[model samples]
Target: GEAAFAHKGGMHVNAVQKVVRSYEHIDPASIGNVRRVLMSDLAGRSNIVMKAQELGFKITSETPELKEILARIKQLEHEGYEFEAAEASLALVIRKILRHREPPFKIEGYHVSIRRDRAMTVCQASVKVKVDGVVEHTIAEGDGPVNALDQALRSALVKFYPQLKTVRLADYKVRILNSGAGTEARTRVLIESTDGKDDWGTVGVHDNIIEASLQALADSLEYRLMKK
Candidate 1:
């Protein structure tokens, strides 16, 4: 069903945009599906224009922000950030350019520690986040470092944005960008989040796995908050 109307390659997508029958055999709406043009490093400006329109923003070839958004996408892709499957991150980029809105919260500092005994292991995290100039310090314990960090971060922010209680991490994926670097290789994290009513994907890339995860995690909650 997905293969029926999902277009990715730049040329194919451009053609489909010009004429749907150029590549599609049936109208997507016939099956209650809509044509999707996936965004990636291979995307053209038309892809950005269409995607922004779908997100409730009008971005034409003449729009100054269109060029900046395209350049930003290309630059991020070069840094090991993939947007084809991370529309939530891509939407944030568009919003940053179009609206110039400030983020709801800022992370001031965070620390994670692991304790091991002969019988078991425990991971604890402490997070300091600033919301509207007031700092919230939170601590949490989880099964692993990432889990602990997630808990601590959310606990710190939830008080300011109560709507975040409904948001949860649905899935997580990690990819090493430079395998040859082995232990020092950069990592890219992709996070899927859902707030019961909607699901979205966000991505982050960094040399440190924990930092990468935090980047993706922060985007997930920020995206949810932006919706409100």
Candidate 2:
């Protein structure tokens, strides 16, 4: 495959990706590798043919589906869902392949209201985030509704896991959660942020909005921090 990627320098990933730190100068993570998986070569899969057979995928190099799956995987990897982080993101995708049960977080309801008057723009955010199947929520006002909502939600989250301060919102994005509607359609928030040195994504929703945005914001910051 590196031969195919070789025609283009960018496909260099097909090589350094398999060798990680052994290659000089690439940030294992810049291409989406996490430190743990890189330090250990456990991420490589070569003798898994029998395992794939056990799962019932006919194991033959001549199998058109095998070639297609490999090609599709390398192609998706081009889009940035690096399966190396399979321990986290891809596990959810491979649940059927590995057969796991349940996921960690559930949302009850999250809401936020932003009001702007002559003097200032007010932001209030609130959220209901659950852990280990237990639920709790908090609401707060901020310099802007997003900040206040983040503050309020963080207040509750820290009580359960105090290590959250080590990380923060590296970036955030909100898209219309409801589509094809007019301006009134609520926006969907997709956040990309860091915890010291790690990055993650989270989502939130609401018509009132500030809290909904904050729901994803606070969760991304705190949960990622907790992970570190």
Candidate 3:
């Protein structure tokens, strides 16, 4: 959903258009796609084939070479393994099953806030960081709870690894699993992040929506650290 603007200094709008056109003539105004690129090896290939087919390309999923891969994918998906959650990760699982990487960072704590007028829909953020046995904390505000929480986490990580500096919150969605009458509700958040190298998705759920955001934010970096 829509969140606050932290660093909108780049041509993200143009980049989005390029990707949209790369796929097909999609009307962004109608779709509300803030970012246009899809980032994943598996999604890349699948998207290409799907786009071609959707744009009237004649092809069959039953190609002798694709049958097994397709079936396996469907099997895993039916079993609850969602590649759509992390495309690079799905492909990596096959190759990296032999060896896993080490984690680079650990989170300890964080805080976020939102005020009037600035009462961001995504109003929360906090980060606890550890590097080389040393610890630090960084917090930032966002348009929503999850966005702010992730921004805080990434801000901390980027200080240690410059590569993380470019990562951006691509999309966020929240679903209420239990009604709160008004003030309290158990919510689930799905967060999507992009940094050009890869894209990933993480989920968080908790009674306090802000805490739920923290849970997902923690998983996001944990996943990234594992890759590193």
lDDT of 1 at 22: 90
lDDT of 2: 0.50
| Higher-scoring candidate on lDDT, 2 or 3 | 3
**Model 1 segments beyond 4 Å from truth?**
none
Candidate 3 residue lDDT tens string, 1-228? 332211121233233324646433545455664322232323323432342243233434443433444455455444334444544333333323223433466676667776666542547666788988989788788766666777778888887777667677777777776575556766776778776787788766666777766666666666665556
Candidate 2: worst-modelled 10 consecutive residues by lDDT: 1-10
Candidate 3 runs further than 4 Å off: 1-103, 117-124, 180-184
**Residue lDDT tens for model 1, 1-228:** 776787777788778878989998889899898888788789888888888888778778689888889899889989999987789999999999888899889999999899997788999999999999999999999989989999999999999999999888889899999999989999999999999999999999999999999999999999998888
Ranking by lDDT: 1, 3, 2
For model 3 the local lDDT of residue 208 reads: 75
Best by lDDT: 1
Residue 80 of model 1 has an lDDT of: 96
Residue-level lDDT for 33 in candidate 1 = 86
| Candidate lDDT values, in order | 0.90, 0.50, 0.55
Please list the Cα RMSD from the true structure of every candidate, rounded to 1 decimal place. Answer: 1.4, 9.8, 12.1
Instruction: Provide the lDDT at 114 for model 3.
Output: 65
Error of 2 at 6 (Å): 12
